[model samples]
Target: MEFDVKGKVKEYYGGIARKVNNGSGKSCCSGTSCCNEVSKTSLIYNGESLTYLPKEALEASLGCANPVVFAKLKEGETVLDLGSGGGINVLMAAKHVGTTGKVYGLDMTDEMLNLANSNKAKMGVTNVDFLKGYIEDIPLKDELVDVIMSNCVINLSEDKERALSEAYRVLKEGGRLAIADIITLKEVSTELRAEANMWCGCLGGTLTIAEYKSILENVGFKDIEIEVAHIYTKSIIENTYLKDKDLDDVANKLNLDEVDGAFAGAYIKARK
Candidate 1:
């Protein structure tokens, strides 16, 4: 039987949103959960930049890296954030675009959308809008956005090609794709691929940077580049992600060597 990759990812993120709503006072942990970015707001954002944003918005930012930094957003340009969580990036981008431009945050999970809307309200940014939708099938019309950005969310998509295609479709001619996400350096084992927990943790669906470039190119993107932020070494994987799981099963069958240097956080950029 095929694993329900989308189902697992949605459930995992939904749980995180519910936690924040319950006053857990914890940031959502998406990619590299607990290993790299959990509760480390300063690790992902600058202190001064976050001051005016909603406090809970900071708690709900579970992204692997900041994609807005890659966008080079211009005034009066519209932006769409795929899988926008907690509305932090949206709010920030709203400031970048000012009152003349708009930023749309698309999320499939209702809990996340609610939390994001709540954050939007707290921030009092009228230019920001949160929509309910999947990343693979964006809710916007074609050639409508000036920039497309996502933070650690596309890796969770069950259908990456379709997602990329939709991203291409929504982008105006020459629109940019500036995103921060997890990428693999090498192929993963079938055993590891079936690990539901790891998938929800943002490891299973990633493709190598080359694969990403190829897919983006095939989808009619140009000038593609991927900047590596950090590589997961052997010790980090073993000590962080590989702990507290059933070792007797197929997951144990994976060679630690195959896992090491296999994943990294990257800034993926391209033109549509």
Candidate 2:
């Protein structure tokens, strides 16, 4: 049977939203059954950076890095966050933009949008709006945004080129793209790439560093920079995505070292 990639991602993340809404206290990507507490600790925003947000927003954060820090948004500048999952980045961007600016959060999942709106209301942020839409087909006018930011969400896309093109179309002249996402340093085996669970976990669809830069360039983005923020080792993957499987057997079958050295969380910057 063929796998439905989009369906799988929606199901996986919708479940996460439900869990979080139920007061499970579970992190999105690093839930209790998937990753160890120590591994979960490795993925965090600076404490001071999150001081003003509600506790619900802090707990719902599922990003690998904080793109808001790198976005350098100024007062009165319009900003858009793609895949704005529980509105963590949206709320943070809202703080930076202040009352003069507006921050738009676009997400495909209804449950996530609901959760993000709830968080936005809890934070009493008047400058932010959460819109339900896919990143590949954003619901905004061309040249309307000064900056576009995404956190660990681009890799979840099935058609990354379309998504990047849409991002380019929506940005104003000289607008910036600041994103944090998973990228592969080397290639994974076909078997691993075929797994729906891996794709939903932000692993199956990663592009290599070179390929990512090439795609950004192809989409008319300039001055592209991709910096490795965290490397994912085989052990980490085991604890996070493959915890339920036979680790040793899976490792041997996948030639895990190549896969280990291949994947990392990266910070990507560019301009339209």
Candidate 3:
């Protein structure tokens, strides 16, 4: 089957939201892979209560790092989350921005939007709005947003350059972009790069560290800094793939020797 990147991302997240809402238990995919558990420790286990969200939302968290730590957000400001799945980050941003500021969650998945909306209501967050749109072309006014954040979502974009252009367009001058994503430390093999599974799971379709810096620079962003916040280990790899019985078999047959030496997670901050 031909892989439709956009459709696949939407479908994948929609399923996640559905599971979160219905409490039917999420299907075992790379989204819940053991790698994700290790990758999320810093974001969920540290500095905040994970009690605000359901298990599904926690399981759906795919971010490589936490953007809120570096966002340096101010009160009465407007913050936009590019891939606000389950509104976990959106809700967290709401707390930081306070009652004076507003938080916008833009996601392509209706199910995700529904789940986020429900969560917003449950939490009594009046300052947040869920937007149904693509990040490549944000449905917002220019120079209106003060900060932009995404968690492992930008890497899923079929056109990353276009997405960055949109981010720059909607942000005010000096507004910052703090993205937590899976960035390759070295070049990905041709075979791995071409795998559909890798892209959907936020692995195979990553850009090298230098390439990520170059794109931000070309997009007219200054004070750009891409740094490693965490590295995915083999133990994490085994855990993530273990959820999928079939994938576990293949994962064992093929030795992923290149897993640990290169870092798989990073945080990139830049200003427009």
Candidate 4:
């Protein structure tokens, strides 16, 4: 049997975008469950800067960490957000960049793209543009972006190396990479790696912190730094996905406990 990793990811995220558009469902793939609304709000976006945007935009967000917070966009700087689900980060970055700066939101799913555009219309944000494309192959011109940001998105790519390479290509001479993604703290087992559900839920396809650094270095990025923001505990893992025997499998493999951090939400920063 063949497992369609990319198809599963697209289907899962496309479903999320549609659900958000229809004002139903919640984010379940960001390590923290969006169905747990209170925790989702506090854990992801805690600032008041995004209050002016459409409520649905915030509700549609499926990010792990606030990359825009870590991005620290300056006015008049061009920014690009890969996999800009619902345009939360893109809109937020637009605010930080002011009117002079331009922000591009790239997503492969048409459903997500439509939802993002709908949110853009609701907010009347002129500086943001939602593009349709894959992270592995960005649609923008080369050496065009001053800052590149993504939130919990890069890890979903089946070919992470290509995705990172594309990220590096779009960045300007002194561009920065401020992204939030899931990084594994432990080695993944063969069984877990083959689990499509885990992959769709932000677990199966991931890299170690060291692997990220090495890839960035090879991609000609400098000043690389990665910090663990939130560790996905046994309870969190259980609550996030698979409420059945799958939980038992993950527990047995990771040997979950309070002290054992199997995976973490990390803030990765680098300069091109």
Candidate 5:
């Protein structure tokens, strides 16, 4: 059967919103052992950064890295977070931009939007607004935002080129792009790429570093820089995606040992 990529994505993330609302305090993406391990060690956020935000925001954070930390947002600057799930990055950006600046969190899922808005209200954060929209076609005016931030969400897009183009379209001249996302160092197998679970797990849709940088450059972004934040080891994948599966079958298809340097959590920085 063919996979409904878009429908699966919504179903996967919408469930995450519901779980957070139920006080689960568990990240949907980190439900597996491999993901849990990565979350504890790979993702970075200062204690002070999490202190002022609603607890729900921290619980719902599914980012591979903290884009807000790399964004270096200034007070009074307008920032937009594409695919801002549960509003963690958006809230962080709001604090950085202050009362004078506005932060917009654009997400496609209604559940996430509701959860984000609830968090916003709880925190009394007037500077941030969560909107419903797709990353490929952002629901904002062109050249309006000072910076565009995203967290591990872009790789999920089926049309990455269009998404990056939209990101460029919404940014002001000289505006910055700070994103934390997954990238692949080597090509994955066709079988793995076809796995819906892997795609939703932030693995299947990843582009190689060269492809990622090229896409940004093609979208008219300059000063592009990609920093490797964390590399996923074979054991991590085995624990998460390959657990209880036929290890030799996968190894034969994808060469597990050769995939040592394959996957990474990348911090991507660029300018429009």
Candidate 6:
């Protein structure tokens, strides 16, 4: 990734983290265009109580699926969560990994780290640690992690190859990478691709499924599987309007446009 692109993502998401962490009513899940149902449902499904996280942490959740559950993590193994926004999945992984194991939440935003740290305190969980860094260049030692998980974050990396390589480097032999994110089934229009807000919001910057797989393969990861679990076009169109009501009325009234070859959510599981 270019320095500017990386910096843009960091700044974009960092501002988002700051907004939601402050307990404002502003929605991070498209800020209004998308329905909150998915977020609410995912939280309940993931076993998060309303008391577990702050309002902003809850609001700022942008994950399309639960990577913690998809990862099949076990107790007493070290787990690392890339782009651990607001510590949602990090906290969940922490509980699942138990005190015998350690969970590391690596994120680039200082505000997000602070929010995640506060959530840790609120939950009384002492087994997790939040670190400041980019996922493309993880701060952990090579071959030290048992599992790597991320939620809708890697696609935004300016250098996804570096991110995947870092993921592989930080994992133990036979370690796995389980990610729940957005992926395109075909080519997306350049217009949509150029939207910085959409890109940062986990929409515009996504890779094609084949590209995602190829990158994992290039990084020496095997048994790569990318599954489409959720189709969020309806929700995205909904969010498009909800997040930015100013879009043309005709555009607003039109149903969510199928991103042609786009899948709302995808799960990628690979092994070192």
**TM-score per candidate:** 0.88, 0.88, 0.87, 0.88, 0.87, 0.84
lDDT of 2 at 28: 33
Candidate 4, residue 250: Cα displacement in angstroms equals 9.1
* Per-residue C-alpha lDDT of model 5 across residues 38-156, encoded as one tens digit per residue: 24423367533466777777766777777888899899999999988889889888989999999999999999999999999999989898999899889999999999999888999
Poorest 10 consecutive residues by lDDT, candidate 1: 241-250
Whole-model Cα lDDT per candidate?
0.81, 0.81, 0.76, 0.81, 0.82, 0.75
Better of 3 and 4 by TM-score: 4
Q: Using lDDT, rank the candidates from best to worst.
A: 5, 2, 4, 1, 3, 6
lDDT of 1 by residue, 1-272 (tens): 28788777778778778877887645433457542223356567652367787777777777777787778899999999999977878988999999999999999888889999988888778998999988888989999999999988888887788999999999999899999999998878888777776776667778888889889999899999999998878776666444422122434556778888989989999998
Q: What are the per-residue Cα lDDT tens digits for candidate 2 across 37-146?
A: 22342356663346576666665567778788888999999999999878888998998999999999998888888899999888888999999889999999999999
In model 5, state the lDDT of residue 128.
Answer: 91
Q: Which ranges of candidate 1 are over 4 A from the true structure?
A: 27-39, 238-257
Model 1 has an lDDT value of 0.81
Off by over 4 Å in 3: 26-45, 52-56, 240-254
Q: Which structure is stronger by lDDT: 4 or 6?
A: 4
Better candidate by TM-score, 2 or 6: 2
| Model 4: per-residue Cα lDDT over 1-272, one tens digit each | 26988898788788878877886645343565335443455556876455687766776677788888888889999999998978888988899999999999999888989999998998888999999999999998899999999988888888888899999999998899999999999875666677776676677788899898988899788999999988877777775533321244544554345314678899999999
Q: In model 3, what is the error at residue 102, expressed in angstroms?
A: 0.7
Clashing pairs in 3: 33-240, 34-239, 34-240
Residue pairs with clashing backbones, model 4: none
Q: Which stretches of candidate 4 lie over 4 Å from their true place?
A: 27-39, 240-260
